[model samples]
Target: MVSKLKMVLIFISIPVISLFAQDKPELHVGGALRFNYNLSSWKEGQKTRGGDFGYDLFRINAKAKYKGVKLNAEYRLYSQGFGGGMLKQGWVGYDFTPENNLQIGLTQVPFGITQYNSHNWFFSINYYLGLEDDHDMGLKYTHNSENWLYAFAFFKNAEELNFGNNSDVSNSRYSYDVSSSGDGLYRNKEINQLNLKVVRKFSNGGANHMLGVSAQYGGIYNLDTENTGDHLALAGHYELDFGKLNVKAQVSKYNYNTKNPAGQSNDMIAMTAYGAPYLVASEGTTYTLGVAYSVPVEWGPISNLQFYDDFGFMDKKLNDFHDSYMNVTGVLITAGNVYTYVDAAQGKDQPWLGPVWGGALSEGTANADWEMRFNINIGYYF
Candidate 1:
């Protein structure tokens, strides 16, 4: 009698579920959980303490669509890299045609390579200077064709982080945003920015190439002086794919002209992220070059491997300021929903790689020795 009653309830719910599925608006939610292990050469204590292994992050990805309207959002909680849980990006968009769309709210800026310029996890050095993979509160229009892509955006400013008792809560967000110099010396913020990006893609002799150019202009508002200065960045990038090998190259230049409160030097600007504020050179040129090769494997549950080498450099024009350099060699392994990266990274006068924790992007040390970090990151995706 109990089995018969359970069968009757199942028979009733299948059609009910099918009915709602046919008419309901579409929604999808997914996320990832990641962890990290690292041993740094610069941290001498870690040598005796053994390498550190810890939680990295857990992030949510959500998308919803109804008719022509769409919504996309991603939020993350970090165990190490952020002050607290933060919204990575959230936007609402509309599709007017099959080839074009518009997005408004906290959206990605169309500048210097659409998604990334590096193959390894540490991104290009340009990311540290606020020139790559940066998002802002903005509106953007994008159009795509078989051989061409274009995007234009107008940003009111960077995402405003929560401020508590401090006069200026500098960091606590993804991507670099101008803040204070930590000493009462300088104050500036990103505002009123415009971006334009165009890409041309072509295929020849079984090889595909993508060439792109991006331009940006923005305001740097000073909190103490109440005057708005300006900042500009321009970049060009090229990518190629032949069989299982990929190559990426980009060059970018940036300038920051800020109006400070009387005694600040124009040669350096203050930028913040991850709950800390630091200085960066006011003017610099950056370059990125990367290459990767992939192979399919059948080692038990392991399915694929990608080996890559990515290099980035920053050239500061200020007098006596040393440049920054980075290179990462790594392999990415995939097994169904589990993915992992094994990387050996080295850098000189670089921030996260580290002998210098602050201002390494600004006036770097004089011919510093290279530092190394052996790291592994693993994640499970849903």
Candidate 2:
């Protein structure tokens, strides 16, 4: 059934391509294929180091524009099967002015660093916390100026799709698990999120700086229990860029409050059994620091090279739980349209940091205090 649906979508694209070709509509077609190789090690009496090869995913992105109106979409086929296939992002927007626009449909929530600086395929720990690359069904308005930017949005649902449910017995395999705003705390809820930033550009000095603030307020509902939960977050971030080096950092504090005390067991925001999710402290503060340096020299088959280090720390509000942190160091090499990432990472109680090798907090693993892993990802875009 899923294969047939995929075929139908593919056939439908043919005519769309023809329409663009005939009308000369602004259109583009491109995508990327990625692969991963993993090796891992565990604590005593636990699984030893092992290796595996897997397909990360295949994506097709298309965009079309006519005057001030634009349409964009991305379709994906995941090796692990994302609800048969997934629509990563699909949206339409109209530009009232070059600096202002209104967008509707599924799009990324405007919050935090739009993209994290990580060499490995997996994003930073913020991703697992619904703070990065998180998309939702909503309406959004954005404004940009020479020295300022702002965004406001309302989402009908936290997330539009997922692979698991509350009764699934185990959430270990779901892409988002409990941290998902839609299914876990804010299930069947409404979310309003906003972001604002101020920028200072130094044209002659070859540098730029930005300071931003973000906030979110939402509610959650459960049909069976008639229970309601609330989600709230406030964050501030800073960014600096020099010709060859860049720095990105953020500090955020949030709360997942529930009307019924019973919900407290799952009150923890973005709780993943292993990885960074394990580090969440119900009502705590989270901080991220990332730095990258681009090398000037380029050699054969490698047009660009960069080295980066990213770190995250979570301080729980409760005194009994331990603070959590993770550090990743890696190099990114790009040759033409092909890119490769090689990285090593270590974390204390941060399972999502080493998702491929599995994390210490992952189910069925001996609870190790610390974990480490090495990874390589190769991808091509055209």
Candidate 3:
């Protein structure tokens, strides 16, 4: 099947190349190699057994621009002790303007702070940002202006990353032993997603501020279990400069749903919503606040030299409104700082490496007493 797909892509690329070859344009290709090391404390039986040194990302990206059309492809390879492999996202985009385009193919839905933010790469924020997954097969349209921007995407089911009620016994191979947002998170034969986002900027002379709104609806049609949910999110970001001090704040909320019927899992039977008609799977909201003080290296050849630190927190409230017995709450906090480098010639690339520490606390008979992680990550784009 993989060979067949590759053949189809090759056939499609031939005609596309022929059409673009007439324009005589420039082709640019590049990628990055990144590594991460975790000095985390762990307990036996925990799913995330820490691998000391992990090749976080090794990717190659190719893009060709001709006339008003652009074609891009990215392939990534990752490895840890368990094993790793490769995946690719190949898409074609046509620009209506220099800053506006309609792109179709596999892509990332730009919905939340962490969705498009690259600064937090070295430190995985699965526990904090609720944006742990990667790109999916989809069609996306994007528009950007000076002070306002928006995007919308339609997607197919990408189930490898779902958790919480969405991963029930019938739909997922794994047992529904643990509970979280995707508890019964399973996709039937039919799965699709629609995501939309809009953002407006504000300023008071010092620096700009942003207000963002996002929404996503995913459909799952399976007879055994219906795994459908919607996500609504709102956020704000502000940047202020006062002589030698800089401050910023950001926050977001994510609400999703899933299901677990009676006698499915031992844990499922104990939940209040088991016998109820509608089950309230799981939901959570998270936020981030940060501040930094920096001074330029006056005589040095450095660009914008600065020192910074940020604090982040996330809280999850999980319960079936119909089933209170299966209820729990989870909280997390993290603090980190890094040396940020800036270079205009590098385009959107920013290199940051830092030490980050965080801890997880939960109540209501969910899983463990507590889970914590400490890691150092270095990331850059070329």
Candidate 4:
């Protein structure tokens, strides 16, 4: 099933490519190297267990554009380089009006209030939004008018899971009967997302401030039979630019329902309820806040330095009566969730500081727990 999906995407890209061949080509290439140090254990008694020399995450991204079409791709290299891989975002878009555009292909699903705000890179602020944790390969349409912006997308449930070349496959068929032995998670899984966003700009401190609201509906197909589940999410973000300094905040709320896949497929009748098929769902809220200052610095091979920080926090209400932190916003906000808690604090700000032009001083946060992280980054842009 995975192999077939790849073929289909490849076939679709051909036409999208031809539509731009007659226009002037546009290409943009950039990447980031992030060397992170986990100061302490994210969980009280748990310690981070991956990365070489405490080196946490690194990413490389490139894009090419022609006329109204763009092709983008990214590679995320993580600790151990084991669960890191690449993804392609191919799309063609046309202007419907001066401010509205229609696009079709793999694109960013704008849902969570924090998901669309690109300035959360330098602080421990969590006041925006959070929802589905992955991207999609499907069709997307966007509209950006004067005071309002809207976006919607239809996506195939599959996202690259950093397993090397196999990052693009979605159909993970578990060989088993509905009542017997199988990888219950992927056997009959289907996923989809519908996202909407609205933004209103205002003024504060003699700077531009924008307030954004987002809503999303997502789920895997046959969630009841396949035991996947469904979710509803809402989020909001506010950005206030104050001359040389800027501040931003965002908030998010979520409600979810999920069914735990049972023992294999065909052998369920005699199963015990203790470990039987069931659902572990949750309702949660998250918030983020950030502050930044852009300072001019004339130094060796450097342009300017931006110092920033962000904080985020999330609280989860569980349905399965489990005490685990998997559903806890604090844990999931990290870079790799509980699996690697390091991500609990990270964002675009750190990379901006280290990008070769902006001198050391730029850093951001992902998790809004009491523990905060700061980076001394040096950056340069051509």
Candidate 5:
């Protein structure tokens, strides 16, 4: 059977070819190569281990256009431990009018904030909750005006690299999604998801502001039970930009109603990325806050500097679960085509900051110490 990605392309080609047959096509290509270095307090002897810097990732972006029809795609290559090669996103779209269009294939789900909800190297906690920068195999419709915008989408599932939720659900994915556990003890997949986002853009007192709301509902397929449970989420987001200063805030509540096998817990579900799976609380409300200011600098090879701090907190509905929190204070330096992020990120019960890889979004442990990581990510784009 053809994979979902291939199926969508096959189903849409005929009309796309005919609709834009008379126009000349245009193509563009670009991408980036990045590297990372970090030191974590939770590691007993990370520095002594003689390990700190390594290749992060390399990605290629391509865009093709023919009149009203367009295609966009990005593919990435990562270290084996980071899930190897993966297609970040690929979509075909058609413009029905200047104000609206439709996109199909692996596309972004409009939610919480546009591209990202954080201003630092370490994203806000919403990302771990699977509510930020999430993408899936779907079709999205969007319409916009001078100050008002709306988007609606229907996702069959998260990008399906393989057919089923087997022992090894391919972790060659860009965004976090519910999936089989690395141990294969837990198995589930996202399906039949619907999403809606609306934004109102305005300015007052010389400051531009945006207020938006997003809602999503979806099914969680339990491979063990052969039954489908559902998930629901709602969010309110706001942003402000004044001169060189910016402020952002958002609150979101999410519930994962999973249909697990007998004797299993329903209070948590598994999500995977970079070939590792971890548990996230089944129900919670997450909050985010961030502020940043950019200033031009005269330092040689450095054109600008941006200082920012982003904070995130999560409160689980279950009384017994410990809450989670994260904060990243950093500066971004831009010089020509090179950009670097230097961050001091701290978190409690967050997986990336911990000694191990998995358990980034799980129920926190009592007396868990806040872990701090000093990180620098540098990339060159062309």
Candidate 6:
């Protein structure tokens, strides 16, 4: 007896396989296995350092393209406490022209920098706020030319197939998790969200520069509380590239507002997918600066060596809350299909700061006036 879930998977695969069999679509299969080793220390409490080692993640991605139609999907398994097996992205798209396309399914939202240029496996702070690796069931239209890129998308839900929270009251304090209790900052499960981004590029003095603007609006209604809350963000980013050197920076201001039947404000604390959520006075500004320098080296099997620094800062609107910031410095070594990242990071008033590859430090209770973590990640792709 096949389970219903398995049956659904089989049904979804039929058309994909048929396309390859009949239309002879181009197919590609690839995957990566990642591992991590970490050591961490805190400023106030434990005088001794703590460490851990484990498999970070295993991921497989497949894509097929025939004429103007394409399909892309990825399956991921996480070993850390993050979660279990899940679909990272699965989308089908149609290309009307080389520069224009329409995508429908579970895909990334077009907001802020699409890719972080950090050498560390862990991305900057924006990632936690649904700016990186954030995907949803939606429809997106994209247009790209030699000098301009534009994207607009609408998502029915911020996340799909989440079973972590079943209770009416959201006990979890994260944004990515479904919250029924209203404890979750982004508790609205049925989110009607819209996102937009536009960028323009130019070249000067052997370098390329890009400037862009991004915006997002999302809302969810809590049936239990008969209230509604919404998330809003507006941001701008700039990127500069000179041969082997690259610099990227972005600034964003966001607000989460809620209203009840009594006309009273019930704005919850701001939270991310992971780490400790903080109280916001309704709005805050986040900034990220990342710089990378690639060095051409022919040492052993090493093809490239890149050193980088990624910094993130958050300024809360509330006067009672202290500012938060994180700084990560790392080196990336690439040898053929294998890549390694060695990183050192520290932060204050930021419990979410850690390795991108998982396994570093646990959430601390006290404000991290100064906490440090060292991490190393190795991955191989085939």
Instruction: Give the per-residue lDDT of model 1 (tens digit) for 260-375.
Output: 86667888998877767778999999999999999999999999999999999999998799999999999999999999999999999888898797779898998788999999
- Counting only residues 3 or more apart in sequence or on different chains, how many pairs clash (N, Cα, C under 3 Å) in candidate 3? 16
Model 6, 139-244: lDDT tens per residue?
Answer: 9999999999999999987544544443332222222432332343333454788999999989989999889999989875654465667878898998999999
What lDDT would each prediction earn against the true structure?
0.88, 0.63, 0.45, 0.45, 0.88, 0.70
Q: Which ten residues in a row have the lowest lDDT in candidate 1?
A: 161-170
Residue 375 accuracy (lDDT) in model 6: 82
Residue 230 miss distance in model 4 (angstroms) = 2.0
lDDT: worst 10-residue window of model 6:
355-364
Candidate 5: worst-modelled 10 consecutive residues by lDDT = 163-172
What is the alpha-carbon lDDT of model 5 when measured against the actual structure?
0.88
What TM-score fits each model?
0.92, 0.78, 0.60, 0.59, 0.92, 0.81
Evaluated at residue 121, the lDDT of candidate 3 is 31
Off by over 4 Å in 2: 1-24, 43-50, 81-84, 117-120, 162-204, 260-266, 269-281, 354-368
Residues 215-299, model 4: lDDT tens digits: 8777733333545566677888787777877776767776655453554222111100111221122455666565667666555
For candidate 2, list the clashing residue pairs, or say none. 274-351, 275-350, 275-351, 275-352, 276-352
C-alpha RMSD of each candidate structure in angstroms: 6.3, 10.6, 13.4, 14.8, 9.3, 10.2
Better of 3 and 5 by lDDT: 5
- Model 6 accuracy (lDDT, Cα): 0.70
Q: Estimate candidate 3's alpha-carbon lDDT, on a 0 to 1 scale.
A: 0.45
- Model 1 residue 92 distance off true place after TM-score fit, in angstroms: 0.3
Q: lDDT tens digits, residues 152-257, model 3? A: 8887744234444434322221111112223332223224777777877667766656667666666433324553434444555444556666555555554443
Candidate 1 matches the true fold with a TM-score of 0.92
